[model samples]
Target: MQIPEFSKEQSALLARFLAEQKDALSLAQTHGYLFAVICAPEPLDVHQWLEQVVPGCDGQMDEQVLFAFMALYQQISEHVFETGYSLPVSLQFNSAQQPYLDMQECQHWSQGFMLGAQGYIAKLLAAPQLASELKEALETAQQSLCFFILDSADIASIANQHGLTEGLLCQQQYEVMNEFAAGFAELIEAVAVNSQLYNDEGWG
Candidate 1:
């Protein structure tokens, strides 16, 4: 699937709107969470999912901004479902402008991802057919996601105590984010396998 690129101007516009609305997740994180949700075995309606993840979206944005937002979402959905990996939007940020991942923003992004996964998690957890290793991986990912929920000041303090620099902290965060993405991808693969089996044998 060909992913559409949003120009810098368009991104700035969307960022402005999200800022004005005091949205918890940044535009990039919003896209990331939406991508994960779309890659799930049982995906929700796009419009409904967007409405839940981004409240007041329809009412607050002008048509152009709204269209751009949906276009980005579609691009992310296509990339995740087709390739089983998230688009590397996180890498686009430069260390100069934003030296490190803000703890608060990371928390918001994790919260959004957790919210998006709520519908599918119960079924995933209850599936007796899932392998033990995969289940453990999923559980570990859940715990990692929760780590971001800690207070930014406290996290910073802990990092300072450990003598971690901004660059080192950013690298650690990326590693964790990569692990989370890999875990989700594994779960999605499991879902696909189960879905195929059910379709073949009518046993879902």
Candidate 2:
């Protein structure tokens, strides 16, 4: 059997993506847990630092959007695992989302993680000024989102332990993330317009 070979660029990007995702997951799961406790506002600081290291981060992506997505994703994750809400939309997939998919426990954590991944991929492929910036953004955003996940999981653990209710926290996060995803949404739209124009000599 042969392992498929990717272009050097693809391999590099994938390697970075995997490494970043690993860091993100670890941070998310353990950051705020009671037994395996995790803490810090450093996660947010880390995001700010990522913006400095990665130029065009704000232009290409929105921090608020990322926050919302993570929040929603974390909620979806808890609900799904605890039999809260199970919609196909909650379990949907795209090429950019696969890396964050976690089945051992919380699926929404993975989903939330991939939400950013999808946006990162779109930016990397489309924005020359932002290529390197995105690399760092992915790394930083992964950390912050993980921390966000950790916090949510901590709350859920308590809720589960004490028999409490989970509310619209995740829905709010999803709305925010969707707003952020709109950045990639626009990028995708631009790519489509450009491709169409080039194909038929209709540049506008």
Candidate 3:
């Protein structure tokens, strides 16, 4: 199914706003951050998550920019809640007439996702109801997403630690990206089910 997205003009404006802020996440990173916030097992207050993206969360930011940013978050949250597996946009480039993933943007997005989801992940790890198999899958998914964020030195260290070659890791990049997305979707479903069961018990 086709997904709704911010228009180029809106994106341009957001980018400008991000550029002006000190230590603020880029547009791509903001998208990833918001996605993680939406999929978190427990809901994070909108103001809380907004502070992560912009840092201040008061009346300092321009009204128009803040409005656009909040609108972007709302759209992404609605999409995830409505259609379970929809991913926010990522960068792609044409190389030799074939499309290739933009690793830099992916790195920023992955970093932002981790930053936003760290609290939820810690809770998930300790939750007794989380099955062993699902926990393992979550680990694999986290590793897959981490690949994009790791530097060459770190990648080499990991490869050597695992007794694997850098060439092998490079060859598996695309496959790992697919795995990351699928695993994230699975995580969302699992957490949603857990939340629902918790709510039902509370009501009962």
Candidate 4:
């Protein structure tokens, strides 16, 4: 069971993410914002963040689970791509691992990694102390997707009151928007294990 290879577009997108990530990782100004937020201590208004991710959601990340996780990654990736250097991503998934991840796996990328890829990102933001302001910004990124669904007023409120959409805040704060990397790593690992199991069982 060979995992499907990267499409040209996806490779391009990955290159873009890597490049931006590299710059962000290096910049004293915009370093590692996405990585931290995703792994921080669960926020009080977790629903607000989740609401911003999944539209028409009156629940938490754990309630609507799959969409929540996918939305978070999609929004973050979209933002990174939307930046002056967008990437060409593909609609490809490792079919062999689908059933495994979709079934055997449960919970968010953080839980899957048994480590907080987002938390690791936060460390990059502060380099010493993970402050409350950074945490607030992290929530903003998490809710970014759901925020798109709302009209300008509501979105503006979050942005105005909490500095949600402020690039300065997002840039200055910590976030783990790169949870996709963590999720993908687990995806490939699961695919490998599944292929082995299938081989052992004499299945394709």
TM-score of each: 0.69, 0.23, 0.76, 0.21
Whole-structure CA lDDT of model 4: 0.33
Put down candidate 4 lDDT per residue, 1-204, tens digits, no spaces. Answer: 232332445434433433443222111111122222332232224444334333344652232233333344444444444432121111233665321121111122223222223433333334333345544544444343122234446545656888466433332221232343334323322332333322333322
Better of 2 and 4 by lDDT: 2
Candidate 2's TM-score: 0.23
Over 4 Å off in model 3, which ranges? 1-5, 83-95, 156-175, 182-186, 189-204
lDDT of 2 at 86: 29
Q: On residues 23-141, what C-alpha lDDT tens digit does candidate 2 reach at each position?
A: 33332222112111101101134344233223335424444434433343344334433533322223335586532322322434434345434443443445444444444544443
Worst 10 residues of 3 by lDDT: 195-204
Q: What is the per-residue lDDT of model 3 for residues 31-130, given as tens digits with 9 covering 90 to 100?
A: 7788777776555776787788888755466766766776787777666656544444433546655445566676777788888877767666666776
Error of 3 at 23 (Å): 1.3
Q: Per-residue error at 75 for model 4, in Å?
A: 17
**Whole-model alpha-carbon lDDT for candidate 1:** 0.63
lDDT of each: 0.63, 0.35, 0.68, 0.33
Instruction: Give the worst 10-residue stretch by lDDT in candidate 1.
Output: 194-203
* Best candidate, lDDT: 3
Error of 3 at 46 (Å): 2.0
Q: In model 4, which regions exceed 4 Å deviation?
A: 9-147, 163-165, 169-204
- Candidate 1 lDDT over 19-108, as tens digits, reads 777544567567657765775665667567667656756545587777777776776665555655542535435656654554555666
Instruction: Please tell me which model should have the higher TM-score, number 1 or number 4.
Output: 1
Provide the lDDT at 74 for model 2.
47
In candidate 4, position 143 carries an lDDT of 43
